[model samples]
Target chain A: MSVDIKKYLEEKQQLVDGYLEANLPPIGTPPTVLHESIRYSLLAGGKRIRPILTVAAAESIGPPPKALLPVACAFEFIHTYSLIHDDLPAMDNDDFRRGKPTNHKVYGDGMAILAGDGLQTMAFEWCSRVDLVNDIEPYVQVQIIAELAHGSGNQGMVGGQVLDIQAENTKVDFAEIQNIHAHKTGKLIRAAVRAGALLSGANLTQFDQLTAYAEDIGLAFQIADDVLNVTGTREELGKDANTDAERGKQTYPSFYGLKGAKKLAQECADRAISRLSSFDEKADPLRGIAQYIVSRRN
Target chain B: MSVDIKKYLEEKQQLVDGYLEANLPPIGTPPTVLHESIRYSLLAGGKRIRPILTVAAAESIGPPPKALLPVACAFEFIHTYSLIHDDLPAMDNDDFRRGKPTNHKVYGDGMAILAGDGLQTMAFEWCSRVDLVNDIEPYVQVQIIAELAHGSGNQGMVGGQVLDIQAENTKVDFAEIQNIHAHKTGKLIRAAVRAGALLSGANLTQFDQLTAYAEDIGLAFQIADDVLNVTGTREELGKDANTDAERGKQTYPSFYGLKGAKKLAQECADRAISRLSSFDEKADPLRGIAQYIVSRRN
Candidate 1:
């Protein structure tokens, strides 16, 4: 039987949310607002898709190790920080995310910026904390950190963001947009998959397959997001709809019609699932996640 | 004989500058402006004090290892990124830094912010690159990453910045200002020393002594800065002078007056040197650095 992806995602989301809340500095912590603002955005409840990918990827290789939890949470922290910064006045200028006022709107731009800065540093902090992940090899931990930083740094997410900003309101070709998405969103997603697999001691063959699987889903996820931005409502998506067109951003939908974009997304999902054919039932969540990426409403 | 700190600092700075120039993404790399903005702020002339401290501290314990350079450079990267973000319009709103237009002024606010973000991630990336620091044990590398992140994260620099922002144009007591400086500037400086010491395998006593030395010098460095802000010329200082008073920020001079602040700084420096009495002539650079803290004109 196919895995019940909804239940799987929910369970994983709860696991991530609980860990983040427990580990985060409490509300009464010094610099209360910075901590509060960080918690506000982080705990504001996105789909936790990135972290769950980390968890699901690890589970595919072995039983989800206890140490996998923090790394998963680290990805969530990085993703949340990126969203907080992207929502700032200097970036996308969005006022809301996930149906709530963005961090800058509530905390003011300065604190929001600090909140993002704090979260980014904390991601590395969590990864390097030996006490939390003592069972994992120090060497593996270094490799995980390298993966996270490389994926998130200039060559990756931030580079993509720069490209996105440059592309705004300008005539951009298909190749340019693909390059942007691959660097911007795909790198971190791939890193999340690799980190999880690395923590679980995936062999070379397993690792390569997972990397291929991650790339397919990463593209599918972005294309699906582009499609949803056009088709979904603000209330349904918990964010501004049709923002890509408004911002003059080039997307799959911009190049192809809605039907064509959806078709591409489905093909990516299919390829992602097919990459897992060698694995047993343990790989089902990975399979389900690929399907879910194209089908999710938000 | 005492170490000639001027020549020593010059040599270390050259080494750091060369390494950074070589390892950083070349100018023609994709996302060119982002890379340019990062290099603009980083390559701009500054004292290179933090990384020098890392190198000096490592030398105090043993010959500075090849692996120590990246960690040393990591501290500089962290320092540069903080300055860039601090100069943002939403934050300090500074028009200039180090006698040059701030990153936001030259590159626009969004790219400046992204550049800073890119630099911050690069710091961690450098720390974890096994290829560059293979001589260092993975466990020690994790420890260094932990130290850097802890000293730079919420409980450290970012938290300190929040405190500094909150104290701006407000009445704050000596204890409050001390707390702010300890968190804001002191923590990272201490981290620099500790990371250097760890890289060179300092014994517990050596580590503790270095920690004590770092604390005293950290306070001294801030107090000296406070004095210079009040007494130094804009040209000499290479940035806005008297900004603390203009902003009504509480500082050592605000509490102690110029004369008293200088006295306090000297006393702290003396104590810092005293902490290094147990070490041989190898630590002369550390002692000289303490003296330089209070004596430098800007």
Candidate 2:
């Protein structure tokens, strides 16, 4: 099962990588610094997890994975913007991300800031341009925009970021940590999955089931991140590790301890798999993704 | 004519102010700094020019100004976000905006970045919620989002910001400056006008004419800004003035000299008012706004 997950993610990542590279704004224009900053962070290697999930969800419907490339690319835009802003001097303040200097470190704070802004707007632009697809209805487009907004706005990632910042150097409870992670990481990940479902016109019942699966996997992914932060090395992670403990950031390991956090992550993965038990073999990728969330080294 | 323009702007400002204050997210539980950053920059005193234009454009058609409040508020969100990002350490590095500490200065760069991101997302959310208005058709809502997206995206403000950043410390031609100003400031201003017109169901002919007027005023506004940056005092501007030349920024005054820049502004304003002469009394506010663009002190 784990081997299948690796193969699946690798295949999907190639597709996502192609879409991302092709869709990014062309380089060499004025504000070249800002555009280059965005492209740098975007093209910097990651697992492409959100986009892969988007493709999987879309494929779970009758549509070909190729049909969902725009949405997959758009989700990456939102995700990349979050990372760029997250690593800013005032936020996480990390100098490096994914083994390279963070956007602000390389491009200066001003252009880095605008790069994030440009990327966020670009996500919506990509969605609007998807009107060329006959299967994607206008109302669905509106729904995707609304979901992306809510996931990224005050009530979601921004809210979680606030909690994260506030949680710094403070003793925080499990519930608050859960709430922060749920909004910060969970909402957008869930939205990515649901956006794929939306593109395929999933019924409400299927959406609810998928939402449950997404919620489980999303939390599991964060927990695994916490675990990796404590356990992985810089070479393996391709960036700073254990920086959470260094910064005293609220993490699963901080509250529950490493072993306990691992246990929680497994439980989440289990719940995520259980949610798709009713589905046919088509749900295998979803299950594989959930397992991948917990088992990956970085 | 100038007196009438002043009165119209003041009246529209009052309405826009009331709506903006009412729409601001309440300081609530969690008390995150990002929320405060957003509110601080948004509520900070300015002329409320963009929102006022939105309302004025709507009124130029048939309805009372109240009907356009959502669209007006949306413009304010975009404008406030731009200001917040512009004040970041990497950009202007300004400590103050609108006579107060900038958002990043008060809230820190990370939260300020998030505040801008949240506000940008909220703009579209506000547009989505315009479903409550019986007067706006669904197609018009789509059009409004499209215009806002285009005006705010890489092709618009973001693109202009990139160009402006690139032009910094580099010799740029007058056409390059015009292109930068058109995307950075003109597009949104024009969109604000077009959005209001579309919301009010203005005929295509009137929409096209109003757009032309908006484009002229928008360019005039930038030229005036360039002129003022050189000639105005910091005490009068409530923010840094002459900082453009100090930073080696490319501005109208930098290339054409102050006198030439002022003349260009006047020409742009003339074109703006010329587009409105075809309308009767309803266009008085628009005409006044064009004149005020070239004449205002700050």
The fnat of each candidate, in order, is 0.80, 0.46
In terms of lDDT, the poorest run of 10 residues in model 2 chain B is B130-139
Error of 1 at A1 (Å): 4.3
What's the DockQ for every one of the candidates?
A: 0.82, 0.50
After superposition, which runs of candidate 1 have C-alpha atoms over 4 Å from their true positions?
Answer: none
Error of 1 at B13 (Å): 0.8
Candidate 1 Cα deviation (angstroms), residue A218: 0.7
Name the top TM-score candidate: 1
The residue-by-residue lDDT of candidate 2 on B1-298, one tens digit each, is 5337887788878877888777767676353576677878888778989888887788778774344787778888988899888888778788877888888778877778788998998887777663434655555666777778888977889888878888888888888888999999999999899988888888989999999999999999999998988888887787888899888888888778889989999999999989987777777788888889999999
